[model samples]
Target: MKFHLTVDNWTVQKTDARAVRFDVFVIEQKIPVELEWDDMDELCIHAVAYNEAGQAIGTGRLLPDGHIGRMAVRSTGRGQGIGAAILQALMAQARQRGDTEVVLNAQTQAEAFYGRYGFSRDGEEYYEAGIAHICMRHVFA
Candidate 1:
């Protein structure tokens, strides 16, 4: 199914936009519940992509420092460029917020995907809930 990506402050719709993506990431993918959510959620802006039926298939969030997180696309919907769309929307929103650098804790396996968007690794890899992750940053001057 195809999707329409939308960027919005999580508050405008709150959990309404993130529920499904979290289900895939936190439950289906086995990412720890604590790792899936954090205190920053309420303070950050969110980006969501809705499939034709209006269900969210992809989602991500941008923190105050322009760090993006929770970038997840439903397993059934993977390999369809949804993740790229989510990242693009989130970064656009971050730029609007006066941020010139966009950052994210990337799942090591997916670092290459982000690299295509001009994001480069910032430091050594680390373990987050048993999964390897690394800090990546996208800077726009």
Candidate 2:
């Protein structure tokens, strides 16, 4: 069945966004709460995606330094374009703020996903929160 979804910018404290990230990162991915919740959240621009039932199913954030992180889409929401929508929203926010480039530490498994959006892997593989990751960057022309 097809599902309808909506993506919107929200404050860092928005509960919907927090809930989505909590489920995807902390619970599903086994990331520690301390490492998952950080001071940078207050200094970042956040976005959340909601399904037709108004349930938040995806989330992401763009930091002041042009770093995109905490990207997550609920298992039920995968393959539904929610992740792409969140990424696009964050990138638009960066472009509007005059950022010349954006970067993210993509979990190794997701490198190909970001690559589809013009992000290129920039460095050797590394581990963050016990998961393999690679730095990826997208330069705006």
For model 2, which pairs clash?
A: none
Q: What tens-digit string does per-residue lDDT give for candidate 1 at 43-118?
A: 8888888889987777888888788988888876789988888888888888887888998999899999999999
On residues 20-40, what C-alpha lDDT tens digit does candidate 2 reach at each position? 888999999999988888778
RMSD of 2: 2.0
Ten-residue region with minimum lDDT total, candidate 2: 1-10
After aligning candidate 1 to the native by TM-score, how far in Å is the CA of 70 from where it should be? 0.6
- Best-performing candidate as measured by lDDT: 2
